[model samples]
Target: MAKVEKVKKKIADIFDLPHDTVLGLPRVTLIGSHQLYIENHTGINLYEKNQIRVGVHKGEIQIDGEDLQLRTVYSDDIFIEGKIFNIFLKEQV
Candidate 1:
């Protein structure tokens, strides 16, 4: 078997240490709801450590995380926030 190399996507590498590269991933700031079509997104920091407001309005998806050191958003439909130590998941009912 050939050794496979893990090629981190251009976008996924931006949030890593030493922000010297512009990977595909970018800091998104959405005013209203926007239909997102993402395949392999590395990290998403909605806002600073302020607050996040996400919802579906008029057939649009909105994500808002303000004043917080936000992190990864997985393809499995999960939200990641806070430092790894003080992280928790909340069920959106």
Candidate 2:
């Protein structure tokens, strides 16, 4: 944690955000105990060995795992759950 604290000031000014704000806020979003979807996500960071798995298509997504989960949905949402071994996105007809 000391490593993070050391650069706290430089990080604040570089980002032009409040100093404590960065430390104060939680970066994770759209989270549930077993599922989560982070908005504005460009890349994924895996913490555990098999926490989640996802695949992207033209406009659809599929996730899988033993205890896969999702936090919430957009106005356009679809939910499928099972012992998901595969997910294939379908184009709108």
Best by lDDT: 2
TM-score of each prediction: 0.22, 0.24
Residue 51 in candidate 1, Cα distance off native in Å: 1.1
* Model 1 agreement with the true structure over 9-36: per-residue lDDT tens digits: 3334554642223222223332233222
Per-model lDDT: 0.32, 0.39
Against the true structure, candidate 1 has what lDDT?
0.32
TM value for model 2: 0.24
Number of backbone collisions per candidate, in order? Answer: 15, 0
Q: Please provide, for model 2 over 25-76, each residue's C-alpha lDDT reduced to its tens digit, 9 standing for 90 to 100.
A: 2122232434344332223223223343332222233344555544443432
Name model 1 segments beyond 4 Å from true.
1-46, 56-67, 83-93
